[model samples]
Target chain A: MNSSNSGNVGIVIVSHSPKIAEGAADMVRQMVGSAVPLAWTGGDIDGGLGTNVAGILEAIETAWSPAGVAVLVDLGGAETNSEMAVEMLPEDRRARVVVCNAPVVEGAVIAATESSGGSPLAAVKRSAEEFYA
Target chain B: MHDAHASRSGETPVPLTASAVLVNKVGLHARPSVKLTQCAKGFSARIELALAADGPWTDAKSPVKVMRVKAPQGATLHFRVTGPDSKAALAAVLALVHDGFGEA
Candidate 1:
């Protein structure tokens, strides 16, 4: 079912602030257009400053592709929540999603660029993580 | 060019090089840097960029490294490319920069 779209890997951006997540996704869109599936989520269920695992999971579904989804997060809480979200996926879908340890905005931009170029999931994750290394 | 015979015998092959000035209003900001890296990654060459001819070069395919260059308007971008497609890679990158990254 996830493979129905183009083979490009998908990207999900997570942050404590909804604005940050949206801004990062905007940057990715500006650079990559619709070449890759992309989504973003942030803030608590109440729309306050915090990470929402449920929101992240929904974002993962929205951004899902057979090439897999790379999740970029802004802070520790976002990372933890993203991991929880990944764990919530069914076993078959779980292995395909990764919570990358990368800078939220820059990583998303780079990851989307790489994914749009027909790179595989691991390569996309590596390229995003290269932001720090 | 340097002696072809000497270059062939040396451990290091002469890298194809080129330079282009960033004429765009904002220079290598986030948007332009993204374009630059995207173009660079289209080739198989080992491409690097520097502020000077002899430089502390950074990988051209890495957007984060390219963004950190922080090259403002009028700054000359020096490129060093080495690989099977080095010539074409250098030309493509120079063309993109000369086009003002499509922003000018």
Candidate 2:
């Protein structure tokens, strides 16, 4: 078997804090490394609105597809903003957006590394695996 | 360019092939890099990444390894994975990139 395509899962990360988003990704590398398909989005971080919602939408449209994509966001605006982004998508595309239910960092890592066959919700659930610690 | 472009349409199942283009303005920093690398480990396929034409190629499943590549904005990496389900890996990569790595 080749080294890269070992899994069929896909992942996406979103956050109100850009640092948090990036930081979370870094932590995952410390543990599992690259083993799944990953995507991410974040707010302006200027403590303002973060990034443009439209930009996030465009990224989602372009990056997510075929088998759909999942999203893991930080608290507060991250969740609301993610909702806005999801709403912007076409009905067909909206079907692919999977939002995570746990802390942003953990959710991002689990979704990115888990072997959930591209299902975001499942990846988020997998993130719960770390809670016992 | 021609051969590379041809593969974008889900053409021939090249041996362990994947691509990473800078979609986020910040490029593949610690966060995305880690996240990207994590996804690479999911599949049983053997994955390798070439940051540039002359750059060193490394395993997609390694974060520290991927970090060394230091993929910057607008920089694109070509990935190759062979073995069963390689096509699935390629598709997932395409989707992630097509999503602009979350920065489009």
Candidate 3:
């Protein structure tokens, strides 16, 4: 972890296709350069095109940071599963995670950049959501 | 270029301006746009970029907006920067473009 990423918000990318999720993560890495903690989850238990709440939970944990975690998802199923995953977190951890209603790849990139700047969770979420504005 | 009279008169200083051509092979693609936005966000000044000098400018600090500009190779990027740190902001953006965003 780069020292600049310390105490910055984390980010998670979720999609129905594992490749899409990983590719978005790669974009974030290229753009922000590990300036923020990042993780991704996709595919179903049988490795099919679907989303799994368990995977999302694990990703959130992997990208977890003291500052908070922001999640960007593709498609409706991914979003619902992410919400479920957020619900599954411990009561204390629930509030720190958010599922942004923004384009997955773009949102993740923008959110990661905002987080790298040491913006708080709410501000990161707002910045990512600005894509729709 | 501090003008004591302008400050005393409570009139805002004119925005600083500069232009740099995109020499990188891929122009202002994802990586370069990201670098530009990240660089722009570091300054407090309001920075905007456009392909032409006159209009249709976009915020330099917004990655999505900056990337959407889709400036191709050889496109010139015009910058208008305002606020107290306008000079530094304009210089930084010009330097980034002149450096080819470190891609060249």
Candidate 4:
């Protein structure tokens, strides 16, 4: 049942600091390996510490997988922007994406590992969010 | 170590089990938890990992439960495997744990 090539959900890491986003994604990549698709966006277009809707949208699109995509944000604004990004997508695409409330680093690693096992979007989100408890 | 077996008049035998210490400095955190869960998923048996030598078995296939145990360095974990490939599953888990999960 392990098809490393396809059917695995994708992951998006969003944070106010580009360094945190990139570092979290890198950690996830190390844990989950190349089997799962991962993307990240942090800081505004000007490279300041803030969330950007366009950047978040681009990250979701870049990491899009047929299975689905789980977006993990660092804080409140990032979560709001990530939700906006998901809303910007077509109805069909939006249905496959979920904004998860989880710690950026630990959640990404947990979500990526679950996604690599070909878990559905909801399951991946649930697994990642559990890290907060 | 706990015994994960039952004696029946006729059957393929009881479950296969293994126990190991959390030798890695980080214990069952992100990295090692991911590795152990992945290895558990590779097998067909129903595997569970317990934080101590006694109770509270968590599904080995789930990274969430594995990390929930909050096992620190020097903690002992018991792996209980059931199903057709119990022996193989136990062996795989022990091998990874014994290898220190590639930690220094």
Top candidate by lDDT: 3
Kindly list the per-residue Cα lDDT of model 2 for residues A1-133, writing each as its tens digit: 0112433344555666566665765665454455545555566745554655764565455435455555666677666777788888888878667666666666555555544334444443454343333
Worst 10 residues of 4 chain A by lDDT: A1-10
DockQ of each two-chain model: 0.47, 0.05, 0.51, 0.58
Q: B35, model 2: CA deviation in Å?
A: 14
- For model 2, the stretches where C-alpha displacement exceeds 4 angstroms are A1-7, A45-51, A58-65, A116-133, B1-104
CA lDDT, every prediction?
0.87, 0.60, 0.88, 0.85
Local lDDT at B8 for model 3: 36
What's the TM-score of candidate 2 when only chain A is evaluated?
Answer: 0.69
Selected candidate, larger DockQ, 1 vs 2:
1
Ranking by lDDT: 3, 1, 4, 2
C-alpha DockQ for predicted model 2: 0.05
Candidates 2 and 3, the one with greater lDDT:
3
The order by descending TM-score is 3, 4, 1, 2
Stronger candidate by DockQ (1 vs 4): 4
Fnat of model 4, as a fraction: 0.62
Candidate 1 pairs with clashing backbones: none
Tens-digit lDDT string for candidate 1 (B6-43): 66542336798889999999999888887888888888
Interface DockQ of candidate 1: 0.47
Q: What TM-score does the predicted chain A of each candidate obtain versus native chain A?
A: 0.95, 0.69, 0.95, 0.94
Against the true structure, candidate 2 reaches a TM-score of 0.45
